[model samples]
Target: MGTDKPLIGFIGTGVMGKSMAQNLMDSGYSIAVFTRTKDKAQELLDKGAVWKESVAELANSADIIITIVGYPTDVESVYFNEGGIIENARQGTYVIDMTTSKPKLAVEIFEKAKARGISALDAPVSGGDIGAKSGKLAIMVGGEQQAFHEVKPIFNVLGENIILQGDAGAGQHTKLANQITIATNMIGVCEAIAYARKTGLNPSRVLDSITTGAAGSFSLSKLAPRMLEGDFAPGFYVKHFIKDMTIALESAEEMGLSTPGLSLSLELYQELAEKGEEDSGTQALIKLFD
Candidate 1:
């Protein structure tokens, strides 16, 4: 086919991926998409994107393939499953995986891609659903510089901050750090809210006060309102945050690091999940203390 414009295919159209793909299509890329459920692709298809039947079909048509699936296993399956991307992807095509996966998996996938003369990068993101919708996520990318530059334009359309961390698995490592920080910050915010309640202080007012002082953070400003309103809707699911935290702590363990805070948060998330709050927003972590 002709190469007038890059053929961009996106997999995983959940909360974050769907908005990201929509922004790319809005920015005028030739878009093709596939999700596990056919109906999830409907909005994009209606907006001028073509739908592919499977990962292989999507890879076949795309010059640049972007994956933003859920967990490490799902990320692996998208590229290596039956009728997956590697089965049909051609040499020299670029693949960027934006899933917050294990760094080891990024290294593994990068080696496999390099063996086939393809370029691969692990580029995970942050800034949550609002960021995804507003095209303001922070992207941490790892791969060859040339391939990063090649994809930078599309990333520019989808994110506000983009950093090339290092080699093959650096992005995933950076993402682990991100999750660790998030886990601690989330715990801190939830605990502060719980503390305020126990002390007969107006939790909302407590948040409003400290939020302007040194005790403030992005998490406090954003999630505090949700926690106060008892709105634990899945802007980002507790299950996904737990997955990220578990991956972070595991990575830390492999490096012989001490992260007691992360361990505590991980256990708390596990407890929350076991109580059927896994699908709820991570702000529901407050429920554990209540």
Candidate 2:
């Protein structure tokens, strides 16, 4: 309601959050940050973020609270626990959860926020860690229309593309759609690369050829280069993709739908996770062939 620049408090400064928070600071917003690991906060702190000691403190001290934690459970703990944001945050504060989480939990949190006269939006993102680093993710948001408008400027600073899908958990539903497509596409990319490697073709050349045709895809164009170079460092971890695929399967089951491709992707990621490559990037799925 105020015309002043919003006081922004960001929690979960992991791979994605660190860069996103830096972008916010660069955009001239006052930032307060909290992370489970204190060292993750140093970059943002050096870049001018005021560090908060806890989620509750961050919520209490700022008007806008943005969470980019790892999973549904972590998100729940941060907002529902004894020292969580809801415990100390004032009414009229805005909360945007950017975690790719369960849609049901998103709805539950949004309802609780509404009862307290606070605004909450479930806005999950695509475009991976690179997107976060560049503030160019495609954000799908779901919440009250007015609240969506109120947060548009902040979203602009965080993402290159933003869309208000619907109310409550719609943003997460959209992200599930995103994951479903990604699950299958990544599988296609893996299979193609494996085929090329087995047939003694230059996988890099194969990547270049397909990427210029209709077969071109984000996973192929963006991830194939890294795969060709044998890089498995984290941009988005294999375990996290597994988590997202698991969420997608659960959502499809609830809707009485079956996605066999995603089902297989889930299984493959589980196998990769068991191999202790959980922290590796999703492109490491190529190791399935090895």
Candidate 3:
């Protein structure tokens, strides 16, 4: 809070948020962090991030707030509740929600924040844990143009592919579209390796042949290797992926759009989650094939 740069309040120090907050601290910005679990903030505290005991405390202390919490319900609780960001943050503060949540909720936050003179942007991210650490995540933002420009430098520190898609809930809509693509892609990646192993070819050899070809994808190039090496750790969790797919599917149905691929993939991911792989990395979806 005593820094020349605007103090950054980082909420939700999870798998990706931890690395992202650390990167900001590493870039010399003072960070105030709060999560439901204090221990999760320890690594960042060791690296010079100041710890706050609650969302309201952090909200009042920082000029810019960034949150990447789990679930739409969590997002609502932090932004709309009595002692939350909307009530506690100073006038003219910038609040960025990087959580993949409901588009309607994003619009509500934007309208409410605007009335209270706070700038709120729904800026959901992609590229997983690796990108968060490397600062290469693709950020899809939606808010007023002026507000987006004001936060672009901060966005630059957190991601490479940053774009202000439109207004209010547009970022969330874009993220749902991203989830739809990834849901189908994960299935294809799983089946490719499964087919290769069943037909007596080296899965890695098959990957080498196809990774740079027409079949190339992030799941193929990055996650396939993780699957082969049996690393089911949460780069991105199966539960979260299923959450995204569910949001995408609901949005599609609302628009009278048909997404058979998204529907099937959601079914597969739901099956994977029900099998007790919810906390595992989405790459573990391949286990369904096995």
Candidate 4:
């Protein structure tokens, strides 16, 4: 491969990752991709992204590896397994984990990468599937300054707002904060719409009235319509949001912080998940009220 651009190895081409990898490919990066579900990667493979047989093969072939898999356990398996990225990647490769995982795990990955003379960054992103498709994600990164700088170009192709939070696990901590805020805001959005419907008011007009005022939020603006239209597709999965909220609650407890609103939101979402709405979008939280 030419030195004009780094070869990118992309793991997990699910809802957001598919669009993110597509943005990188559109920006002229050569990509190698791997995912457990081969059919999910068929689109990227057809778009000139070489399909690697495994994560290690992708690691060996690419100069920069980025992973955005499910759950913290999935993140651990991809990086710490015997045939994982750290062991198979060449020296000096940059490894970036964009999964919203535990901060301690991010630190562990960073330390292991440092021991092998590789650079690692925990770069968790927000803005959901629409943002990913539009290349307008907000990427919060944590790692060495130089490594952050080296990867900024790749991030620029994938997001509109990108910032390096601090070293090691800072990005995951930042993401938890983001998720906490969203948790409460989502409850408010659902309650407002539910109240509007119960009072015989037009929910759409009510949304227009408050959405431009202090009541407006990313959740209210983007997801409220989906709730109204009954489009419960997974822009961001309910199960994944539950995972994020669980992490946030644990972190908050560790810090001796109280988050009653976040706790309530988590409870409501857990009820939804228990009803088999786990595969639905986060907006499906409104379904409980409906």
TM-scores of the models, in the order given: 0.96, 0.98, 0.98, 0.98
Better structure of 1 and 3 per TM-score? 3
The top-ranked prediction according to lDDT is 4
The TM-score obtained by model 1 is 0.96
The order of the candidates by lDDT, greatest first, is 4, 3, 2, 1
- Tens digits of per-residue lDDT, candidate 2, 1-290, equal 68889899999888888888889999899999999998989988987889888888899999999999998999999999998877777999999999999999999999988888899999998888889888999999999999999999999988988999999999999999999999988888888998998999999888878998998878889998988899989889888899999999999999899899999999988999999999999999989875
Clash number for candidate 3? 0
Better of 3 and 4 by lDDT: 4
Q: Compose the digit string of candidate 1's lDDT tens values, residues 1-290.
A: 24366899999888899899999988889899999897988988999989988889899889999999999999889888777877678887899999999999999889988888889999999988889999999999998999998888889999989999999999999988988888889889988888899999999889879999998777899888988898998878999998998898888989899999999999999999999999998889888877
Candidate 3's displacement at residue 212, Å, is 0.4
Residue 189 lDDT, candidate 2, scale 0-100: 89
Clashing pairs in 1: none
How much is the lDDT of residue 286 in candidate 3?
92
Pairs clashing in candidate 4? Answer: none
